[model samples]
Target chain A: MNKCHITNEIRKFRFLQSEMTQQELAEKVGVTRQTIVAIENEKYSPTLELAFKIARIFNASLEDVFTYNA
Target chain B: MYRKEKMILASLLATIAVFAVYSLYVYQHYVVPKPEIIHDFSFWGKSFLFLALVMVAAQIIVHIVFAIINKIVTKKDIPVISDEMDKIIELKSLRVSHLIFAGGTFLAIGSQAFGIQQWIMFAKLFSSGFIVTILSDITRISLYRKGL
Candidate 1:
């Protein structure tokens, strides 16, 4: 539980997408901007539902948004 | 940002403040001797009365705040402090709090056994308990934010 489980490529995606703001993504995905910030910082693992929502927003698969590193 | 948490924090602060003020009143006016005419049994009675009042007042304030916050943020059912992630964080914090509490309590016992000042030992226990509780509360909030 203390270990950081999920890793992601969100930073690369944000850069690829015209340096998109976290709040814009969060608003599209129906979550608070802080949630997006937390995800980007790796300080939080998005819920399964939020994970899917993010992948959808990025037009990518779940593995594109998040993955279990260990 | 959630109303319920703000409400609860406010209640905790209010309760602690009210009791603290009442304690100040007792200590200043009644417990110690002063130059003027001494206070009477009423002060003793009042102290006891306010102690009870403090407890009751704290409980009532907590409930009232919860109710108001609930109504104000009616769309969100209950607070956001509880969830699978928060539950995990709470469990971790409780473990840390328990360890500190036990260790501090043991140190107090050891000091008394070695004949260090008893008042100091008591103070150690009191202070550690306060620290542990505050630490636990903070950990819970941090977990809520960080989703650990």
Candidate 2:
């Protein structure tokens, strides 16, 4: 089944932000490293609050970070 | 996976394994014939209660020991923080668990309607509950591993 319709550029953003590690992002966002991995891979979609947090960390807008395909 | 989630899954799997071995032993020794079990309901009930107690006690002790050892090694207290993704994963896993449990219960009731023995019904209910709980933990662990 197609579970997630949302995709993200977390990896690219993380790289642009001085190559932030998954653990670093996770710590900053108060989540686990695994969650970042999942979000980057598009296997899981983050809530609006978490999405905003990630975008804020990278100094990017929500649209620049994530895209919803239908 | 989150550290606390991993710990919980490990503990639950270990407890289920222990219970499986113990139940096998009990079945072999105490539940040889149908009539014998009927003659001593307390034996079955007491054994189940004791095993449940053991499982709970063992889980607590194991978690405590794990925490102490982790503290000693890391020298810092690890805090588990759950975010929105964690909560969503938890809810998804819970939905799956509830469906499995409800199906098992309906099956048990159906068996009773078909004139299945009371002992079998009880066993079905008990084992289904245990197995589904383990499956739920496994689901959570896998979701954390591969994503939800």
Candidate 3:
């Protein structure tokens, strides 16, 4: 099976936003910290809703938060 | 390790221990005494019913004890809500378990067709159930560790 190559700039955005921790982002996004870690590590892809929520938390557009490469 | 991983590991251990001890007790108390009782359908039915009840009770006790000990040692609460990733992993694990169980049932039926004893068929069914459960737990732990 082909692997997903979805990547995110969540770490960069979090850093720019007062060095927000993964736990804080998780709480805001209503997910577990482990989930945020999985997303940042490219181990799991969030759903559209979760991705939008995350981008909204950083006050950024969806494209700015996540990118997918075929 | 994550609390989820710890909980799974604890459950896996409890499964093995409970199954082993229960099997030993049943063997000593019932199978060794009359041996012919193994062929009794009613005996098998009662055994399966009791085993199911014991397993459910044991799992509840194990979870409660593990949770209390974990809280005292780590001072952290276990996550109460499961996220999407957790649900996906659970579904995948259950799929594997169900597939294995189906295969086990087929093999058990095949054995009966080959003129095997009825008792062996029941044993096969029981063993398959146990194996699927253990494999499911292992699959969950592996998915958590390696990512899905």
Candidate 4:
């Protein structure tokens, strides 16, 4: 299977936003900290709704948060 | 870790342990004896009954223990939330586990070509379902920990 590289700037964004912790982001986004870790490390791709929620938390656009590289 | 995931892991372990013990009993009593009437309905019925009883007991025990632990250790109401990634992980693990059932069924059919004993073939077919379940739970746990 061809792996499409879907990367995120969540860690970067989190740090820029007053060094927000993963737990805080997870709580604000209604997800678990492990999920935040997964997204930051590119282990799992967040759903569209979750991606939007996360971007909203970081006060950034969805495109600014996640990039899809084919 | 999510309490539900931990509960699943505990339940799966208990189930597998029960199944292992049951497998040993079946091997000794049914396979070793090689009864003349391979289609002994009573024998098979009792075996299934025992397995079902063990599974029910294991589930009850695991839930009680989990409840106690939840009350004692956490002292907080844990929310059970299923996220999108969790669903994806479940789908992936289930898809892989289904392969085990498919392969086991194929192998069971192939065993006929080898003139394998009917009782042994039946046992293989029966155990395959449980094995698939155990493997699926293990896969789900692993994916949760390591990422899907």
Give the number of the best model, judged by lDDT: 3
Per-model B-chain TM-score: 0.62, 0.78, 0.97, 0.77
Instruction: Kindly provide the TM-score obtained by chain B of candidate 1 when compared with the true chain B.
Output: 0.62
- TM-scores for all candidates? 0.55, 0.81, 0.95, 0.79
Q: Across residues B11-35, which tens digit of lDDT does each residue of candidate 2 receive?
A: 8777788788878877777776554
Encode model 3's per-residue lDDT on A1-70: one tens digit a residue: 2365789999999999999999999999998888899889888889999999999999999999999987
Fill in the DockQ of model 4: 0.42
Candidate rank order under lDDT = 3, 4, 2, 1
Which residue pairs come into collision in candidate 3? none
Cα lDDT of all candidates, in order?
A: 0.68, 0.80, 0.91, 0.81
Interface RMSD, one decimal, each candidate: 4.8, 2.3, 2.0, 3.2
The 10-residue segment of model 2 chain B with minimum total lDDT is: B32-41
Q: Residue B61 in candidate 4 has what lDDT?
A: 93
* Best of the candidates, DockQ: 3
Docking class of 1: incorrect
Order candidates by DockQ, high to low.
Answer: 3, 2, 4, 1
Better of 2 and 4 by lDDT: 4
Candidate 4 Cα misplacement greater than 4 A, ranges: A1-4, A16-19, B1-5, B25-39
Local lDDT at B31 for model 2: 76
Q: How does the DockQ of candidate 2 come out? A: 0.54
- Candidate 1 residue-wise lDDT, A1-70, digit = tens: 3666898888788778898788688667776665566678787887898789888877889997798988
Per-residue alpha-carbon lDDT of candidate 1 for residues B58-117, written as tens digits (9 for 90 to 100): 768777767766777675444333443445566988998999999999998889778786
Worst 10 residues of 3 chain B by lDDT: B139-148
